[model samples]
Target: MTDGLYPQLADAFPALASEIAELLRADGEPLAEAVADLPYYGPCTCTATCINLLTAPHGSSGSSMIQLERDGMDVI
Candidate 1:
């Protein structure tokens, strides 16, 4: 079985992971152990948050445009 959200989150956003770990540690649960207890299945398609965030367009001064450059994430 695959590791839980923590691993994917850590890999995708280390800064976020560190922040989350700090928060969890303050609650007396270390990140390593906490993540170990988390359940992982497969891709999540239950909510629009993920899809919206991935495909959302961002604008500055003029107009909005789809980002053409993502690290290694597939856009399809």
Candidate 2:
């Protein structure tokens, strides 16, 4: 993921160790108990807000922009 997409996770926890653990569990990937015991901080304040906007689950203004970016359009 881009740093811009997850600036919080990247800045706080470069590896996203906790989120990776959760995803592993959800995907049924066996992980060491110690791995799950690692501490993780949630998204940074700014990134938390961005995450909220990106994952509203109802409506999103940037969805089109995201799609355009995914389609290789230069938003800049």
Question: Against the true structure, what is each candidate's TM-score?
Answer: 0.37, 0.25
Could you tell me the TM-score of candidate 1? 0.37
Identify the runs in model 1 with alpha carbons over 4 angstroms from their true place: 1-7, 32-43, 50-76
Question: Every model's Cα RMSD, please?
Answer: 13.6, 14.1
What tens-digit string does per-residue lDDT give for candidate 1 at 1-76? 2334333444555564455555555556544344323332323455645543121113213354322223455332
What value does the lDDT take at residue 36 in candidate 1?
29
> Clash number for model 2?
0
Which candidate gets the maximum lDDT versus the true structure? 1
lDDT by residue (1-76, candidate 2, tens digit) is 3334333332455454455555555546565233434333342345434542222223323324211122354321
Model 1 poorest 10 in a row by lDDT: 52-61
Q: What lDDT does candidate 2 reach at residue 62?
A: 38
Candidate 2's C-alpha runs over 4 A off are 1-15, 32-76
RMSD of 2: 14.1
